[model samples]
Target: MTRITRRLALGAAAATLAAPALRAQGTAIRIIVPFAPGGSTDAVARLVAPGLTQRLGAPVVVENRSGAAGAIGTDAVAKARPDGLTWLLTFDSHATLAALLPQLPFNPDRDLDPVMLIGGAPYVLACKPDKPFRSITDVVDAARARPDAVSFGSTGNGTIGHLTMVLLQGRTNTRITHLPYRSGGLAVNDTVAGHTDMMIGSAAVVHPHARSGTLRTFAQFGPQRLPALSDLPTVAEAGLAGLEAEAWWGVFAPHGTPQDAVSRMNAALKESLNEERVRATMQEVQQARLVASSPGELATFLAREVAKWGEVVRANNIRAD
Candidate 1:
């Protein structure tokens, strides 16, 4: 054969060999949301699933496998075949589960490959509108004066909301009672009903009441205050500098997944995040910002979160079991 003909023949053979791998990458994608449907994490997963399907040219499905503060489904994805077919859509809890529930079936860092940091939003601390607490300063003052008289409700024990309070207590050298609820909505409800003195959670969970005048927002726990709530002060701005605590979500796949598959999914996710509908749903409905970060960036972020929260968990002796 001529030199050109030989080169063409070799290229065709290589293409044939790569055909199976390409097909595998196109297989239906299963996204595992480690929380119940209708929550923010599920919202993010469902919001992006259709766009992912369009971009990757394969059906995308989001399955809720809720339990153990998202450890069950996360473990399932961690143990899944690393063919990139299965992925985990999890919230900030993914990084702290190891510290909270030491009995987790899988090591989040070791068993899963970071795909992307989808997005994050800071939690807000709110109180009953009629309560005397008007700001973070008032809350801290009252808590310090009355000790455990200022009770706070959290989504649950060992959750970000709860830990943020613990961190606050350590920072201000104050005492506050912690009331753990099964869900953030319920926690917010109790606070609004005057059953709890205060509650801290995402805007979706706690801000609506503030807007409605049912609950009063005392402070937001983020690096900077959100423009929508620009009048409100951040926890740092209020008094506690360096006390920013943002709840973040991210996607992960089983370790050993092919880099090609990871890259394809990552690209699809980035595109989906940029979709107008997806962005609107996250911003308006779920109250989260879109953070489409690379796999390496996500890995670094997760490590930092794990270390930061792990210290709080250890110091406070927080545990799920």
Candidate 2:
């Protein structure tokens, strides 16, 4: 009859009511890829889906809901029930969404919880083989000379590739027009066809053309050069000291999922990254490295990336329009 006793009874009843719902789901998990199939995000998700399915003792399915620059699929995951069954496999660009769009259906920081950071691929600054630019400085000098005439293409606006070029332009105080394509393939194709002056895109996506001499790689966007393209210098080494950016992916679940579930997902992903087949597949694609990080680490990393890209976006006056 006492207040304290009543409060304790209510707490116990709530726990009892919640237990069965949690127990009923067990371990069945779904991983959502925001982009279409065959891209890096899909590839990364498929690579670990089987291992996760085995480790969690449940089937893991990869669902692609590609559209609206990844907003459609990401919003689906954010609005899903926070029971840990639905997870999102996305890239670092998700953080930029909040800054890019005038309005967003979901708050990435509030509606999603970090599960793990999968890995990243460096972006390569490349040009047509016959183009006069041979290095980052060469491109900078050309842009300086031509002003907005030196055009650069990216997968799309707000993509890592777009932002990387923005950062480069900001640092070197040069101007370059932007051509945003729906995919990296399109942008790279245009650049190779001499339709665009340059392109900053994923190494894996651009490496083949560069190797074939159709495209010439001037520099890589990362703290260090990638082994697959060791001859190319890092942007810093190429004379841009602070310009480092890359396409990175991570896993996240809807907010309010149990901490234990997040931990299990992180552990499973980490194990998957260590698998020889996974490593080989990533390397074959020219992905720089597979970094399996803890959930907390991923959360911190997302926060930092958001701030970093926000500065670049604002400074460059980049708007979705």
Candidate 3:
């Protein structure tokens, strides 16, 4: 081969090899949901994937890597290559796990870059329909009258339901017996069966039971009352003015991912959230409100959540059981 022809061929080979690196769009983007399929996190990832694919002009897919209370999949994202191709879609437990489990493999705050706050739904404190308690005030009065006698069911220790109850007990200065179950369904069932006096769970989980006359929802934990559950007042309106808790979801990329890539991903996320179909799916199916927040806003929110939940975990001596 002639030297000129050989040089040209080599140049072409180099360009071909470098094409993936030179391109702004990744070959594919995988959203790692740290839970099983059909879970809220997984649903959110799938709901947003199509819009993200359209916006970023690349294939987007969801991968479930559930285990160890989300630590396994979350660690996968934390240790993934910082090429902006892999991200995490997780719930509020992401912030509380670190405090509950002392030996996590990855540092949630330092190992992942915040992408967006996504959104969350208020938790509902409901009781058996036969229970006499009419409001949170009634429940508190009963609890104050009989400390540790009034029991509440929660999904598990260190879960949102459990921790929120911890915060409630702290704020109310009441000592209620807590019965942690293996699943939210079990907790709700127990509450409905009247085995437990009350339970604090997500609106999605308790709303149907409440509608069916199995459970009586007293209040929802949010800054304001939920329109669908208009009869149930807000936690603040129920007399705990400063208490606001919810089951939130967010997106995060591996730390040190390029700023431009992060920005592009965030924009795609915002666009996906604004899409009519995505909004309807999230609200109607997942019962989650959409929050299209900037990366900076997500970072701030994550910091606050981590700190706030961490305090609750420590103060209550909560552990993952």
Candidate 4:
């Protein structure tokens, strides 16, 4: 082949190879959800994937890598390249993981950079209609009256819901049986089927059943009452000493990822979150409100969460199960 022709072919090949480097939009983006599919974390990632694809002109994929209470997938993202190709969509358990697993491989604070604080939904405690409990006060009274007779179910052993109950028990000097289910659905089903006396879970898990009249929600573990559960009282009003817990969701990138990439991803996330479809799904399916916060804000929120839940875990002697 002629020198000029060979040189032209090589130039074209170089440009093709450099395309992905020059324009990040040319390659696919992978969003790692550190949980199983169908949960709020995975659903939100999948819901926002199309928006990321639209805004960045790149294919966005949501992959569920569930294990070790989300450490496996999260660690994968933490150790990933900072090329903006990998990200983590995690749940509230993220903060507690550090305190629960002292030997955690990656430092959540230093190994991963927050991209966005999607939103949070408060935990709600509910019971079957047949139960004599009418409010948080009634539940407390029942637990006091019969220490181990009043059973409460949660999603898992070390979940925020579980800790919330533990906090309540500690503050109230009550002893209620804790029935940890493998999944929220199972817990909710048992509560509805009268197998369990009561249950604690996120608004996402309990709201629908409450709305459907299968469960009677009494107390919301948040600062204020939710619009949907407006009639329900908050723990503060129940005189629980400001006991509040919310299940939250967020996005993160491997630490040391370029600021430009972080900003770009944050912007795309904001835009996607604003989409009516996304907002509707979050509220209806996940019972989550949209915060759509900046990276700095997310960082601050994450730090507070880690500290708060770490204290809870350590104080209660809770561990991953």
Q: Which candidate comes out best when scored by lDDT?
A: 4
lDDT by residue for model 2 (1-321), tens = 999999999999998855634563455678998876656677678888998876776778999877656777899999999877899998767878888875888988899998888778888889998888788888888889889999988767787788888777778899899998765667778999999988888876788788888999988888887887888889888677877788888899999988877887887888877889888877776464777888888889889998988777776666653
Question: Considering only N, C-alpha and C atoms within 3 Å, which residue pairs clash in candidate 3?
Answer: none
Per-model TM-score, in order, reads: 0.85, 0.83, 0.78, 0.85
Question: All candidates' lDDT scores?
Answer: 0.83, 0.81, 0.82, 0.85
TM-score for predicted model 4 compared with the true structure? 0.85
The predicted structure with the larger lDDT, 1 or 2, is 1
**What stretches of model 1 exceed 4 Å from their correct place?**
1-28, 192-194, 212-214, 284-287
Badly placed stretches (over 4 Å) of model 3 are: 1-28, 36-39, 57-59, 128-133, 141-151, 179-197, 208-215, 284-287
> Which has the better lDDT: candidate 1, or candidate 4?
4
lDDT of 3 at 6: 100
Backbone clash pairs for candidate 1 read none
Residue lDDT tens for model 3, 263-310: 888888988888888887677655677787888898888888889888
lDDT of 1 by residue, 136-163 (tens): 9998889888999999997667778789
Cand. 4 Cα-lDDT: 0.85
Task: Please rank every candidate by lDDT, starting with the best.
Answer: 4, 1, 3, 2
